[model samples]
Target chain A: MNPSDDAGRSGVSRRSVLGGGAAVAVAVPLAAGGAQAAPAAEAASVEPVTVKVTVNGEPVTVRVDPRVTLLDTLREELALTGTKKGCDRGQCGACTVHVDGRRVLSCLTLAVTVDKREVTTIEGLARGDRLHPMQQAFIERDGLQCGFCTPGQVMSAVGMVQEGHARSDDEIRERMSGNICRCGCYPSIVAAISDAQKVMR
Target chain B: MRAYTFTQPRAVREAVTQAGTDTAFLAGGTTLVDLMKLDVMTPARVVDINRLPLRGIKLDRDGLHIGALERMSDVAADRNVRRDYPMIAQALQLSASAQLRNMASIGGNLLQRTRCGYFRDVSTPCNKREPGTGCAALTGINRTHAILGTSDACVATHPSDLAVALVALGTHVHLVSGRGTRTVPLDGFYALPGSTPDVENVLRPGELITGITVPRSMWAANSVYLKIRDRQSYEFALTSAAVAIEWRGRTIRSARIAAGGVGTKPWRLPAVERALTGRPATPDVFESAVRTAADGARPLPHNGFKPALLRRTLVRALTVLAESR
Candidate 1:
């Protein structure tokens, strides 16, 4: 979660992910009918599972708890936090990531099951300092409110655009129904993704 | 959440051997992992059977054999499944979110647990979870309870949309146990909630579902899956039906219809199928067929709207089929 390495250029300060409510909520009650009263370290005692993931363009090996979700591993272990943790119950699209180039909810997926498979997180979407076109559109259209759910939204939008799925506003709405925005920022979000889709096409 | 042991078994024999000792088989882990995270299922050992080559999709002499490990997404996109068995493909595609469909397997989908609030809670007294504990779903906040298969003990409906379509297809299941291999009609695999709601399936100890065998049929080519719920997507069916038809020129030769979100198991409507066979494909035929299909269907206090909704969905589905025919 330390963004000190590339903060200045992205204009995202370390304070966004550290020493704030954003960092605190990650450890609080995860969701309704969910446990928010534990630490990620406590989950480590369960089992030290080792799995090799062919992530994006590279193969990376990590040891984690057997209970660790793919979403948690991306954010906590690899610092690939572009996959958001909206509802964390597979109900929301904020945790959307790609497994072998197909969209999947990272929160509902287990790291153990993704072994030796190609996983694309939001972190790998951009080429070096170049922003992913979808990310650029979000900025251009102001497609965010609190920004907690932006990363997951951006990742999902990237998947839809790359797949040529957003043929119309209705199609976009149906495809994006999996993700929810409490701030009612869907209009702008859809606009941003649609604009990006035009460019990607 | 106690710790559990994990074993990756590459063969069926190795998995069956471990299944004898309180082990749960892991396929896609979509539903199982969610339940486990909620502390609903705490198995002592988990047998990861993904290494086995059970992810098959093919058409042969006997029928279609779909491997147990085949993901829902793969099945939905399969050429044969889409072209021939439209109901199966549409049902699989209509379930859950895109990510879930990608991770959920056919076998796992068939065996998914009920989405009942009581069954999911560790603190709740569910007959399915702990036999003789009594069901809280009987009269307590039973909005999503089943009406077709209800006893005083339980009322929760089975939660797979794809299984309903498979039932309409008259699919048979292949199981591999330590003793040997055997096949059972999918309709008979699930048991009613009469006295032992806990024993939901007839699966013997150490028996693993190998694949699904859907017999070759002329009806498969003209099929549809219709799901109706509170929301447009990612929600369980309120009253859904899977329809497949065989046509003799302008007349319907045979029909396969089943209901979901309204039964203890995926319910095959014999009455409806009987009505459709040998009748000319028409709007009147569709209406009468749906009426007979749900005849004598009992509705609970909350789910009474389903019988009517089911009929409408069937009419709409049959009309679609008629046009296509």
Candidate 2:
């Protein structure tokens, strides 16, 4: 099966159902005039923008509100929840994803701004059933504890290695400081990245 | 976050024309989007300026000309910047996280607001957030507040580490609008928080930052940026110093010093620079020169340590630069 077809198959049905329910919810209120009518009237006026993005080598087009973040769009619209949102602010690295081959915090990036860019999320890292080398190394080295920050850690590690700044352990730690593991899995994470460095090369 | 219209402008003229009091220019959306989420900044329309042809890094006979839209990570990783302007490179590298650095532009970094807790929380009384509201940071938690160029209306410190280096190296900020183009000294670009704490910069309503030109100087080659933070990485500076000095054998010909995290704006130390000129590059001279750094500092209750910290940071940066020679 094609990757884009798989993504579209999962996204189309869920969104259509949600869209139908939302339209009914808005219609019923507008049909009945009350104090609740004002908010529903305002909701109707908001223009939805169609954004075209290449996700995981798949061209995914979706209409989202301009306020929706790239992180929310990936998780909610495309049903790719591999990218977690730790802090909606840019402070945390949990929402890290590759945009045009560079790492960026998706929570702070607007979905519409990345119109036709290539976005590679955690789900995009694997090749069929085979896990990425970073993912394999993380498991081999026990690089995670709670696993909440694991996806971001793996993504950031891959980006760090690709940046070629993590030549030594100290440099690895410094460059990888954006992603936090509150479970104190620093040593293991560093070891896994160090091991993956050789294999990735 | 309030819903707003996002329009991508292809040219500088369209972007400036679209900008108004109720509109904002969005480039690399790191700071603007964060503030919009926090409800600190509410814009009816956000003009996307990323598509404008303002992204370039050039080294010419004048000096280094960096586009305002250049990413912080790209600027830091530039070979010319790393070799010739170590202070700028170090400052850019030491700012924010790697993810943020990759997304944030140089222009957005300069225009980033303070990290004051009250300013970010919309419910609180912050003069910066809503002018005429009382400043909660004045008597509340102010450990990270400013000690220089501060007034009763506001005390939040400028948070850009890059601005400190730019100001120290005598960079020129190029501004363009429908009116025309003009250049301003980066040092004087930031407005001091006097009675009007809301007006943070000298930028007009429709003006756009085109790029910055850093003049090549003998001092730029031997410059250094030292930042003192609570953590080793991915943290804002408690106090930072950017120093560039020119030495003739054993004597100092000229010096440029600027500090961050302790001033309402990027604080330039002309007095210290003057004190170092013609002076021998020695520990005693550095100590005496830095003593004048806190000449007009008005320390708050929780920030009494900042004046001392600022002086120590400058001394340390000067010591490192001197030792490198």
Candidate 3:
């Protein structure tokens, strides 16, 4: 059994869960092979952990399982699916979101833990339908191939620009390494980021 | 990923009181959550330790005190840390990714589990996950496994570049349990690959890492991390070196050296440090000192590149550090 085979046996049968190493909460269920999907913990069993999340400048209140992932909550409950889920295991950055203005992988975060904090997803990157500079640059530069890792790349680029990490190509590559473009369109990706820096400036 | 009770304690005392035989402290959710998804770890109850008021970054006489809850990105982005402690910042920056660094905590990085394939697979019997079940890596395809400090039981390398840097910085970790708070040298955190490969760290059950402290010295300002992986970014190290040395005239005042991707833990090369202590800051000296990187190395069939790569990384890291200084 190779490492990949071992990883495959660990609930990933087809794809190699590689890319973002952290921020992936892969809750596929326990090794209870025959155990029916445990019904969502009932309200009675659920702790009414009041999570006050300030999302994209708007304060919102929601009741969540202490274990509910920020990714699923934002997508399924909040109807914000712009943050796609390529590899739910945090190996892919498709679900990257911003926690307090810093990019974080939503799939790996617990909703209850981020209570009383600010959360930002790709859906919040725009203002009145005007795309963010990074998003615009990506469109103009064709940074994406299949558009799966685009949202994450865009979010990360926005973060890099805001954080002043877009000074050099090596830095851009080091910073953007978290988002994987399966199409191997890294040259365009870097170009888009460089363009975004100028556009945002 | 089986649904387990998520317990958030207001304090470490309460959290330790709540931990049990089947309980696991959930930190950063970077490593633990992924394992749970694979059914590799099943803690009936998960005690979320993030909200325990254990977050801060401070520098004192001993070293830098990074609370376990301090996000990796915060440390990397901190102006003071970047100015005074470049090695720590570089280590944190060179880890997973910006998104990951933002979510991952420094304490959690220290406690990160191995990236071995068998341990993550449920169908396979990984001695690390289920002791005595047998180590599949022995006969299995193990390209990313360790090439140093390997025993027949297990040979997994500690994966954190931050840890490798921490070891080189001579950092000590502070832990809090129900009993009291105490500090342990980073060198003692990881256990040797003995029969019980299932166990990883030296911390007792229910012990929580509260903070990591590194000594304040000129060496920290001159430290650097050089990781050689398959890809330029977002990949675990094929081999890496963290070198923090202080030079006085031509003699070395102090030298801290450690390597990743080739050890059971973030290997602190005291041999290399001893070799470099009185030597001049030159390439030949660096080469001779680093040649012992794998002195006791026992490389598997597929990992022969490790010893040589480790040497090259050592030279590269030293050059980078010397130039930065």
Candidate 4:
């Protein structure tokens, strides 16, 4: 089977459990089908580890395979699909997220390492109807086309502003180079970030 | 990725004890995890050392002590590092992406593997990956291979921008384990790709890098790192230079230089430094000194342009440093 198909098979959505809407530390039981498409013997022999992490704001305890990345965990287990997966490798920043208020590539981060740490994804950036200033600026500046890379760009832009390096266009371009825009929305993205950085400052 | 048992060690001693023959230490996970996914490195046990208390960045009488666990972005943004060692800051800023910089640690950056496609692709034969398999890049598409310090077994270039800068400034890598502690110069830390390209470094089985110490010098504050890559940002270097020079009036007092993207390891240009040691900082002197920058280069078929590019990059870096100060 193809790898993408395996990734989809791992997606046993936990949306219903998460929609409970309280910051409670809920321990969800692991499903047999939630395991990766490894050999039957290997899957049975391998043990899953328990991870206690705070996503968005709610504390979540999940039993996942040791090798599962935070990107897959966020997309498949938690059903926070806003954080796209452009390249599973670290080459693309599509899976960028804030771990302890610092931006990091979720694709390269193992879920177990984020145990007891706070995670912020693209879904967490909005508050009710009023969106984040950066998100609103992205919409006003027409910063996206296909919208595949928008989540990562917005998250990275927010992080760049927090890092205090959004001083100039060149600096912004350099700092934001991690997230690739396949649709080439860099000009509009820069404009959007420029607009948002002022308010963010 | 193959199945592995993961454990988080609370202390350095615990982390060291958990490491074994088929085990890997996970920090940042930028290099190790990427390779694990590619199947190039398969470890049965993974020891996560993120919680180890090794994050320290300070300048003392011994020089700048940078903890191995310190993230790349934090080290680059440190006020003292920016003010005293601009080359280190520039190298760190110009590396991977901002997100990667936030995740990658200083020690992990030094141990990053080469970006050679042949080395990365498991289908192809790569001596560096699997010894005795023979090198695919020796005759295949090798436009980005090393032009210096290459052997018949391998031609992949070293991939760290921060390493070139640290080597130029006389840095030492500190290591620790259950056995004891030892220090090695950054220059001698890397092993040449003579016949055994798989043995990259001199680290023992369970030795963990604790930190690095960069020697304090007058030239460090005036130093700079210049990287010429395929693109303007977020790419590996095609040809890069890290230069630090101390001047006596208009004449050069001491000079240290190292090059990247053209050598199996961070290539030090002592001949070029010797040529410029007592000369006046001028265009003619720079042009003449850089002539020896690529002294014993052995360029492959596709990477023949690297020798010339290395010389030009060095001259440009020196010119920029001379004018800035």
Candidate 5:
């Protein structure tokens, strides 16, 4: 059976859906298990562009389908799952990461666009065992419950402080509005950011 | 998202030349990528124009020239935009979230599609998304549908707060294509949803927006953008007013006003502007002038409150502008 037929039923084919770095990990196992194998003709049809990106101070080269997003590349490809994907759409800030020193929704950022740019994920914040001020502040303030949104919240707070918008509690709440803590940890999150701001400065 | 070949053009000329009927110029990727994932927009060729040098904010003797590729947050934070064009700055600040504002470009923000639920869901019928497909929002849940500019075909509102401020300040959009360059007033750039609801803008296929110019004026410095939404932040407006007033002594010399979340396009209110000109800047004048806000408004079943809301929002904006100065 052609993979396109599966796409006809599901609106997306496995061959076309494997744009994330996790594609290699997921595809090889399935192929070895003899579950399904993408035909060489279908595989050769896609043109993967090579991109040289600096992620977390490490220089890396990745060849990805143009459709792959930065969030998928980090989580699935590079296995840097520290940056969580809450909503694949840009609505949720769980996929937030710093591209070129600015906080942006990695889910909406195409991997090709980040070529030759510096991307700092949540994993990059700590130096060795010493946590970034924001990370330590979140722990002290009990800023997280389930901690799914912690990485994005911390990353966004760091960027927000660097942008000089985290001056007051009200301002911190307004600036940190993007990262939604579904566990209702907004007060703690705001407190954490406020605490981190002084130390980070 | 659909599979498509992507190209990064170093020059604007090369980017324009690469454009075709089935090609899309990617910027920001907020609206385009979101829509593409829903299969609403399926372009065969995707052109990444991020590498182009269209990112700058310059003010000359003419006016404020904002490059098309400038990010929303960067433009909002620019000294000139914050100091001279407060309405533009406030609009950008109030739109989306911090993350989106950082990623979204000014050029793509103007061309963002409507927030109509019917248009977003491919399962539903939207004349704007698919022409000849009957509009589900016409008789469905349309509490957020447009009231000022409603046609039988579509009733979706234009979702840009910045465009409303830009239109009120008399901004001109700079466009460039393989054919050449031409400038169009931002007010006239958007097409009304009449017979062809699918055709949103006047851009010819492959045409690109280079920059926008807002003519410097004393009134713009006193401008204010007042948006009333269900939520206090991170939501599209139920009714929004962008008002700029030029005061001469106690009376108004000139007034520039535009409304959002009530029309198919950023609506300039010349009638309201006429009511304020040469009149004393008072609460009475603002209330009476704002009454004409819903003069020709055609309200749907659920959106009957918009006209009243538009009037109140405009009055509040005018009052705020009057009081602030």
Candidate 6:
């Protein structure tokens, strides 16, 4: 018998067994059945959670699903698309944002959890249309190629400098290892962060 | 992620009372939120414990007392921790990324699960993820699996670099439950995967980790944490060692050693420590003593190099510690 059939015969929970290869096959039929039960599930599951957060510098209130991550809330709800989403998983630092002046992965942070905390995204790095020092340094040093990971790199660099751990080049690279630039722009990124540190100091 | 009701508990008593089989206490949400997204952990209720007054890091006359809610970055950057317990700082610095270090809590770091690919992917049959389901890492891509602690059920390595250092420092975990407060040695906090792979720790249901206390010792000042990994930064250890030695002039008075990434839990090397006591603080002595580290190791097909690597890591850590001061 197939694994799913075997799983069923063994008295395992369907959801537990559905985690395997047969998920796709089971999901289609499950979705059809779920559609009939959608209204009831939606009423129970989609209860909006209200959260008040100070994004960038402005305090704002938003009602979102409890499952909605801070990254999704920032990009979709607040229209702060500067914070990129490379890998929705916490592995990539593409969704790095400062919550209460500390860098954290936005994809892993539930929006409801950070309810009264101050959040600083990439868009918050400037003062009235003037580029932040790190952003200026990134441009001057050509710290980015393709520019997808640049926002995260710049934001993480800001956080790193604030944390005071980037005293040397090796330290800078180590501290900034979270933001991965697959375009092989690491040398330039390090250069940008180094230059930004001098100005920041 | 499945929809779950969230409650913020203002007090530790309230958090403990709210916790149950279907509930999970949220700290940094670095690991818990990630696992929930993968559907690996689907707690029906999430109790936010951040509001609880458990964030303290102080070096008292007795020892270093670290609150459970203290963030990893804050603890690593603490002046007392950096001066007296350098191994703790080094281990925290070498873990995950800077972003994660800032987000993860000291208690949450100790409780972080394995990074085994099979356990992470819900589609696979992982005994740790679902008991009675066979472990895929036993025959699959298990280069990162444990060699020191392995059973027929699981081979996943404990992923915290900080835990290895804490175990070496002889840290004590203080836990609080509705019943009362109790303490367990850090080495005894983790459970080895014997017949049941699902149960990873000895924490009772509704029990909360209040803090950890590391007793003051002269050996901690000379401690070092050496981690070998695929990359120099932002990668988990292949075989890491945390070594702390107390030296009186040229003779070693006492030694403590622990290994990570090669064990189901943080593997303490009492044999290696016993072998180093009274021996002169020399490279030859360190090299000879570390040989006993792999005595009881059960290396797997893909991770046969771990025993040798673990030994070399211990030697390197000891050498660094001996050379310092």
* Model number with the top lDDT: 4
lDDT by residue (B1-325, candidate 5, tens digit) is 6567789999999999999788898999999877876778878899999988898899888899999999999999999989999999999999999999999999999999999999999999988888998999988999998987779999999999999999999999999999999999999999999978999999999999999999989798899999999987788999999999999988899999999999999999999999999999899998898878888788998988998899999999988888888
Q: Residues B128-180, candidate 2, lDDT per residue (tens digit)?
A: 88999989998899998899999999999999999999999999999988788
- Please tell me what DockQ candidate 1 reaches: 0.36
Model 5 stretches with alpha carbons more than 4 Å out? A1-44
| lDDT, model 6, position B239 | 93
Q: What lDDT score goes with residue A65 in model 5?
A: 72
Query: What value does the interface RMSD of model 4 take?
Result: 2.8
A52-136 per-residue lDDT for model 1 (tens digits): 7877677777775566678877666565656777766677778888888888888777677788888887767879789888989
Model 4 alpha-carbon drift over 4 Å, by segment:
A1-36
Q: How many Å off is the CA of A108 in candidate 2?
A: 0.4
Clashes of 3: 6
Best by DockQ: 4
Q: How many clashes in each structure?
A: 2, 0, 6, 0, 2, 0
**What is each predicted model's overall lDDT from 0 to 1?**
0.80, 0.87, 0.80, 0.89, 0.88, 0.86
lDDT of 1 at B71: 91
Q: Which regions of candidate 1 deviate over 4 angstroms?
A: A1-6, A9-47, A54-59
Pitting candidate 4 against candidate 6, the one with the higher TM-score is 4
Between candidates 4 and 6, the one scoring higher on lDDT is 4
Q: How well is candidate 6 docked (DockQ)?
A: 0.32
Q: Supply the DockQ value of model 2.
A: 0.41
TM (chain A), candidate 1: 0.77
Which of the CAPRI classes, incorrect, acceptable, medium or high, describes model 3? Answer: acceptable
Arrange candidates by lDDT, descending.
Answer: 4, 5, 2, 6, 3, 1
Per-residue C-alpha lDDT of model 3 across residues A145-192, encoded as one tens digit per residue = 788889888998898888888989888988888888899888999999
lDDT of 4 by residue, B168-257 (tens): 999999998889889999999999999999888898887899999999998999899999999999899999999999989889999999
Tens-place lDDT per residue, model 1, B243-314, is 998989999999999998888889889888998899998888888778865665667767778778888988
Docking class of 2: acceptable
